[model samples]
Target: MFKSIAHSLAALSDRFFHRANIRLKLFYAMLALIVALIAAINGAGHYIFNRDFLGYLNEQAQQRMEDMVPRLEQAYREHGNWDFIRGQPRVWFELMKPAIVEHNGVVPPSGPPLTPSDLTGATLRFSLLDAHRQLVIGYPNIGPDARLRPLLLDDTIVGWVAQTPFENVIGAIDLRFQQSQFLAQLIIAVVAVMLAAFLVVRISGVLTRPLTRVARATHRLAGGDYATRVEVESGDEVGRLAQDFNQLAMTLERNEQLRREFMADVSHELRTPLGILNGQLEALEDGVMQPDAQTLRSLKSEVEHLNKLVGDLYDLSLADAGALAYRQTDMDLLPLLRTSVQVYGERFSQRGLTLTAQLPAAMPVHADGARLQQLFNNLFENSLRYTDAGGGLHLQASLQEQHWHLVFDDSAPGVPPEAMARLFERFFRVESSRNRASGGAGLGLAICRRIVDAHQGSIAASASPTGGLRVTVVLPARFEEQP
Candidate 1:
């Protein structure tokens, strides 16, 4: 039960307090506080006024009842009681006058013996009650069962007047006026609180709505949606946030612009030399000069290095632009692995690196054939480049759950843990100085990443048990063929 109550309270608080913008939260908080205060004040005012009014009315009723007690006692003492009431004598006319004025203009009948018709509209009526419930009275209007104030005599209980009316004319008038005033005040309080709550809600929404919009824009910006911005309609916190969001978006866009410009600058710096070297090499090969074998070999090697650099740059450019193409097909991967190994057989033999392929006779995969070939080529070249002389390089293919897994393990210096994470970042080199020595322009893994992504697969690098870098590629065994 306690947990249930706690959950209910938590849900209620969440609904009332959790908001998307600070300004909206503040506005709601202030409005709720104001409403609570107003309601408390209104309730207190109603309670006090109603209590005081009822107390005053009750006190006045008791006071008049007490004052009439002595007059009724004197009348009973002087007159002959029940028989005298029918006679209705005028001997006590002066005494009744004061009581008449006190009882709101009600007066007893006077001047000669009066009939019941003559007593009509009088300020007071004299009455008597017998043990048999019979009215022995001056008029029929005051009956034996009529409600009346008790008449006491010298601290002794006596027979009561059966009925009586208020003697003061102004008492009823005053009461009617007080009732009207109280009702008006009560209505005003109710209306005022209701109007105030409504106006507060409307004005708060007007002020905080823009802030909500700006908050959403900021969230989008933080999520790398640089294109998002808000329009400022007022000179306020909301407007300031809008202005800040626009400024932030501009700054991010400009930084991105500068980064693209820097990449272009680097590309131009590397490409210019390759273009010049290629032209010079063509000119030399046209028999412009008869170069020695050693000189020729040196120039050819330089040309090859230049070609590699240009190729790496081109691959990086395509990957950055998301423009790498693929030609996906479903085929057994074993034959493809054999074919790639055969092309690099002479280089592997020369380097004294043992290249071995361990693959299933038939393992089906749906992927781009040419792109997959390029991907494997990069892995093989990377392994051969780093593997020490007489070291072993192994290629394996197998099935793992829904994916076809390809792995390359070589005996070479494994990648450092710190550099492993950034291995696939464009132009990110593990050893900046030594990368060029190994004919690595640092774009191989990046290209492999794009190819794997195009095939909706994953490629990762880890330490192999052979104490070398292990490259693992996993692709879905079958894909819906793209038309």
Candidate 2:
């Protein structure tokens, strides 16, 4: 039995706290408890305080009756002058009305003295009784139901004042006063309980207002409204949590922007080379251009560029999926840098440019050799393609800390400072004024970036001191051996 009760209470508490919808259950429950408590307190106070008020009124009435008793006794004993007592308002009106009796030439042992004030509208009854308890003088109006107050001298009854009909006596109790007090107490308790209930519900609403705001913001977010953020004015935990949520939403929005930009860049890069190849093929088939060696060579070059672009796109997809394989091996950094420069040396020389490579003798680095070679070749090709005629390009390799640093600086009118930030972004080209024919597919640096990143390294571009572009590559000095 006890376990069942505890389980029910626990379930009630869970519903109170965890239920998402506000159907006014808690508010109603709190209001009811507050009202009940207020009524109990007010009821107890009313009973305690007003209990004395009724007693006081009843006591005052009793005291007035007691004070008038002596005056009535004196009126009967001194002179039998009932007129003196009847004429006095304090005695006759407040206490009782006087009654006159005839003695019938005999002294009575006792007689009724007076009638009560409540019997003023009724007929007065007079009676004179002899010492033997026999009535010597009696009025026919003296009914048996009359209430009589007896006059006494030395313990002997002289006469009596009688009021016929008991209705007059019963009316003197004055119960309306008690009823009024009770009504007043009830009114006060009801008003107080109602006021208390109102205040409890109002305060509960104020407390839960923050929760309501948070719920609204969450709903907006669920509808794909990333801009919705909770702005709480208080410094409470809810306020802090709201601030944190807003920050998280902002971060997610930024990441989504980056993702969109990356995709656009990828599409632009792939489409440019494909468009050139398609146009060249259509021209050849239509006989607009002869199938000469030069036209065929142009077609072959565009096709090669398209192939590289597709290959880089494929590699990026693999990298994003965390499926890019890295075959790590210890190799000399200088030989790799020298080899990249050698591959591009003939092309640079043909363009009236100088290719210089500065390498430290035998600095060994741990990396995937094939991927590292690809990284250098991509960077070199970028510099070679963008540099002006007769410009000089520099390649350097050295050990920096526990890592290898390979850098390329070209003295071409390199990428503009404004465009340098996006140089490594896929499909981003710095030469905005250059048309598609001049600007090769722009995925070279992006491919370089992914290759370097897969090796757990960094690559970025800066404005070279030589008034050209400087590309830097930093790779880890050691590697974890593959199992």
Candidate 3:
């Protein structure tokens, strides 16, 4: 039964917590805390004040009784027994009058002598009793709650003085004061709670505003609105988050633009070759063009262009999916570099450009030879397409602390510094018109980057000292056999 009750309570608490928003929870928590603190302080203050006030009243009553002791002794010394003062109500009342003691041992008048009627409504009430406990004067009925103090003369009990308990009257006054203070404090607490609640709500709104904007922007982003952005207003973590969100949106926008451009470029490239093939076939069928070697060669060239485009697309797709095939081996890079340079040297010469290579005897690397060849081929093709006639191309290789560094620098008309950073982005072309004339598709550098990355290497492009493009390749060197 206890376990079930506990479980039910826990579940109820959990539901309440889950349903309450952060702002409401914080406001309620702070309000409850402040109220509890004020209640505790007010309760303690009232308790302490009442205790001390009652004690002070008791002390005053005792002092008034003590002052009457000396007078009673003097009155008894003059008159032999109770006959002199027994029937004298005025004398008893005068003896009971509260007196003030001064520094010079002089008894000053406290106030006008209190009458028997005044004692009824006083804060401290008293009764004077004879030696036999009979009421001589003052209040007739002494209640059980009254404190009794004996009047002594020469260590002999002559009579007794009884004081009414101060608890009732002082408590009434203390209660009135306490109630007034409680009401005032309650008002102040209400105002404080309201102000605190407003501040809490304002602060929570400020904190959640950026998050709300990010959430809204995310929804817009999902709806294909990549241009959505949020305003950044502070230097805190939330502001940083907004900045990141904006950056992500900007990147998505750029990628979307690139995607559209890639599709258009692909369609155009395929259409050109397919259209040429269709036109030539139609011409042949209509006998508009003879079935000569030139006509056949032109058809073959278009087919080859279509095949190359399809293959390049396939390679890029595989690379994107991380499914590209690689047959890595420990091989000397010098042979591969020499062979590629030799193959592209003629093409460079045909373009009226000079190609030079400064290679080591043998630099070993752990890499896929075919991919390396492809990477170098792409760099060479880029130079062939972009470098003007009479431009110079230089390839140099060196060993640099566990890595082999290969640099390809060409002469004249280097890429802009800003554009150089984006050289390896797919479908980026510095000279769009020249690329179309050269029958180039601008995926070469991107593929080169992918190949180098797959080999756990780095590739970068910069402006060469000779006023042309510079491409640097770094590959991890294979340690030679110690034998």
Candidate 4:
């Protein structure tokens, strides 16, 4: 039963704390600490009053007893008998007051004699008696523990003055002072806790409001609302977090736009070839065209174009999924470069373009020969398809800084400066300069970029010196193989 109770308490507190947000948590923590401190101060009040304050009061009582001796002796000498002060209440108070021209440590002295009212109920316990030990007109209850001092006249004992000291003086005062002090502490603690709670609420709210907004925006973003944004009002970490969240949302929105465009372009590209093939087959079905070599070739060409587009799309998916296999070996790049240039030379010439080459004798590198060949093929195709008639492509390879530097500069029909940065982006083409009529779906350069990245190299596109586009490829001589 005890174990179950403990477990239940633990679970209850855990639930409560978990459900509380940062502002409430901070406010509760700070308020608890301040209340505990105030309780501690109030609890120690008795010890302080007993060990220090009460001891000082007792010492003063002893001093007062001594001060009264001289005044009583002088009073007896003046009256010669106890008749003058035997029943006088006013005279009794005068004698009860201290004869010293001084004051309590706190209350300042006004004139001559000082009053005994501040003695903490000690004055009312004083009494006078004759030499025969008979009680006079003061406190009636004098017990055996009463302190007595003699009145001597010419060495004869005349009478006595008695004061019964309280047995538990400090403990008695403790009761009276404790109640008053507890009330004061309760009021002060309440005010202090209230102020602390107010400050904690304001501060914690300031710190967590931005974070709360970011969390809400993130939830909306996950729900496909990519356009959500947060207002930044401060330069603290919370503000920076909001800024980073805004940037992330912006990037996701742009990517979503690109994804829609990519689907539309793929559909258009597929429909063109498929529509041509469909029309040709329908014509053959209706006997509108004879089955000749040229007619078959035209239908075969449309099927081949559709097949190539599908193959390119499949290859891109494999590359993006990191499933594209690469077989790396140490090979001289000069032969590979020469072979690709020679193979594409006829095509460039057929298109009324010149293909020039500047090859080093032997450039050694660690690379995948087949992928590098594909990268070179794509670069050449981009120039051949897009450049107008009479323009040519210039290929240059060199060794610099332990890297294979391959640059291609083609003539005429330059890319726009704004489009250069996005040249390797998938499905991006300069419609103003390199029209859609001359280019495939724009996946060639993006695939080239992925190939370069796999080889742990870099590729960039800029303006060609020959008034066209320039492509620069840099491959490190040696690198670790990445999985």
Candidate 5:
């Protein structure tokens, strides 16, 4: 039965809270917590007051009974029996009065007088009994409920005085005092609850405000509003969350810009070669030029350039998506580097440039050899096409601690300092130094970077000490046997 009730309550709670907004849910949660605390404290206060207050009154009654013992003994000594206070309300009242002393500078009256403050019914609830334990007078109900004190006369037993504590608070003044205490507790609990609710509402608002803004901004960002951002209000977790959200939005915005630029660059790169091919074919068809070896060669060269551009674009896309096929083997990069240099050496010479190399004889690494060769060939081509006549290009390699470091330094016709940072961006060209009229379509270095990254390596470009562009590649040293 209890389990079913608990399950019902849980389902009801979920129904209310599952669809609620965060701020309202948090407010209700905090409010419930404080209300439970208030109920617990109020219950504890009531229980303690009911128990301890009665105990306190009982203690005061016992003290009064003890104090009246000696007085009763004195009365018994004077009257020779319990008959003096027996059935005499006046005598009993006088006997129960508190001992008198000087009040300020005045003396109390010389009589057994009743004070208005003794409202615990101690005077009337008392009983006197004989030495044989027979009740003389007082409250009729006297049995196990009595608190007894012995009366003594000259070290001998005289009689007994008994009292009953104010356990039920029957008198008007005592009942009012008890009721007032309960009322005061109720007022305090009500005020505390109201104040707690106010403070919790304000606090919940303060905490959830930034979260609300972030949620809205996230929705906007999902809706393609990449420029969405939130103001950071503090240096806390919530503030950091806002910072991260703004950063995500900024990244999306930047990526959107790059995507548009990529499409434009691709279109321009394709249109140039295609337009040239169309123009040449139109001239031949109109009989404006002879179909000789020179015309055929020109047509073939344009087709080759267009084919190379499309191939480079395809390879770059594959590399960017991490879908490039890598036929890795245990091969020394030195041999591959030398092979590319040998192949490109003639081309560099044809362009009136000298190529030199200072490579280590062997550098073991587990990598895609063909991709590395492609990387080497592209670097050589970039230098081959850009360097001025009679200038040279230098290739060097060495083993750094746990990695192979290769540097390519070529002679003049250097990349501009301003373009160094974006040297490896796809389709980027330096307008001042390296133009489209120069040889590369500007994707070689970008592909090289992707290949190096796939090998768990880093590539960077800087101003070479040789007054030209410097490309540095660092690849981790590994072996198929070691793995």
Candidate 6:
């Protein structure tokens, strides 16, 4: 039961402390620290001032008492006893006063004689006594607590002077003055604390405003508002954070657009083959078209298209998931390149395009032969489908600087400069139309990119000198192979 109660109390405390917003927490923390610092400074200042000021008053009183000794001895010598000084408060006070003038100004000799009331401000009190230790003059309340000094005449002690330490004074005026000082200090400390708190609140607001914007932007992003952005107002870490956040938002926005396009393209690509097969089967069932070799071949071609699309999608998924199978081998890429060109050279010719090959006898590379064949097939197919009739197709290969460079250049109609960068993006097509009449699911270049990347090579597309798309493939060469 005790453990449960303790846990409940701890949870409640956590809720209380943690429920406050960051701005409030920061403001309170800064305000508390500033107030504590100011309080400590003021407290130390008061302590030192009180100690030093009291010490100075005590020193002055001690000096006055010592000076009174000579004056009392002169009076005693003239009177030959304490009779001249006894029962005279004014005379005792005058005798206690220092002979030298204070630095502020000198007092006139005809000025009013000092009294116990006058010395109260200085925190000093006095009493004069005779040779027999009898009280003569000064404060009636003087006791052994006061310091004593001897008054002498010709080396014989005439009487004793009893003086109070500055600390012993408890007069109303002194108490009132101390209370006023304390009140002033208290007021000053309160004002300082209030001012510090106000400044802390303002500073906390300034600091937390950017964080608030980021939080709001995050909320919007969570709600699928990928277009949300924040303004960067400084060259500090917070500003950098805002910049990074903006970049993240832009990437998310671009991804969202791509995702929508991918879904649409997938649906359209699927529907085309499915619709053709459905229409053909329905026509055959309705006796509108006879089931002949040509009809069967048409259905088979549509099925193959669907199968190819599905296979390409599967390959992409595997590559994205880092699960694509690769059978690496050390082999001559020159023979493989020659075989791919020979296989596609007739297709280029069938389309009335000139296919030229610039070959090297041997180019060695460590790669998957089947994937490399597929990569070359896709590039040739792209040129076959997109290049206009009578255009030229060139296949060039060379080994340079421990790498194999393959260039595929075809004549116009070519892809736009702006479309070149996104040519390798999945489901991206320069045509903007989802029709497959030109024979591609737009996954060919994307698959080619994955193949080259898996081999630790780089691929890029640019404008050819023939005003066509120039595709460059660079792969690390196995230079140790003599063949």
Give RMSD to native, each candidate: 15.2, 15.0, 7.3, 8.2, 5.8, 6.3
Q: Write the per-residue lDDT of candidate 6 for residues 373-464, one digit (tens) a residue.
A: 98998999888888888897898988788888999999887787788898999888887322237768899999999999999999999999
lDDT of 2 by residue, 1-483 (tens): 999999999898787755734536655575577668767886786676556643443344343344444655675667664544433444445333333455697654464443332233332233333334344333335556644556577887765544344232334344675577668877876776677567667865776687778888878877878888887778888788788878877887777787887788767776777788889889989989888999889888878877877788788678768787889887776677777778789988997888998887776777788888777777777776677777888877777887878778888475667887787776677654322355665677877888888878898888887767898888877644799
What's the best-to-worst order under TM-score?
5, 4, 6, 3, 2, 1
Tens-digit per-residue lDDT, 195-216, candidate 5: 7678767887898889999999
TM-score of each: 0.48, 0.56, 0.65, 0.73, 0.74, 0.70
- C-alpha RMSD of candidate 4: 8.2
Using TM-score as the measure, the top candidate is 5
Candidate 1 segments whose C-alpha is farther than 4 A from its true place: 1-322, 432-436, 479-483
> What's model 5's TM-score?
0.74
Better TM-score candidate (3, 4): 4
| Runs in model 4 lying further than 4 Å from the true structure | 39-169, 436-438, 479-483
Q: Give me the displacement of residue 205 in model 6, in angstroms.
A: 4.9
Candidates 2 and 4 compared: the better one by lDDT is 4
Per residue, candidate 3 scores C-alpha lDDT tens digits across 1-483 of 999999999998777766786776777777888889888888887787668866666666766677777777777767746677667778877776645446488655766655333444432377777789888767665788777777777788887878776664456776897689878998989898988899889987977777778888999998999999999999999899999999999999998999999999899888988998999999999999999999999999889878877888889989999999999988888888889889999999999999999999888888899998889988888888888789979999999988999899998777777788888887778763334466467788889999999999999988799988899999999997898
Global fold similarity of model 3 (TM-score): 0.65
Each model's lDDT comes to 0.69, 0.67, 0.82, 0.83, 0.83, 0.83
Q: Write the per-residue lDDT of candidate 1 for residues 262-349, one digit (tens) a residue.
A: 5875676477557756666777789765577965776676677677777867776787788766667777777888899988877899
Candidate 3 stretches with Cα past 4 Å from truth are 1-26, 32-189, 201-219, 290-293, 321-329, 346-354, 387-392, 411-418, 432-436, 465-467, 480-483
lDDT for each residue of candidate 4 in 184-208, tens digit (9 for 90 to 100): 8888988998898889878988888
Question: What lDDT does candidate 1 reach at residue 365?
Answer: 81
- Pairs of residues clashing in candidate 5: none
Q: Tally clashes: model 3.
A: 0
Worst lDDT 10-window in candidate 5 = 112-121
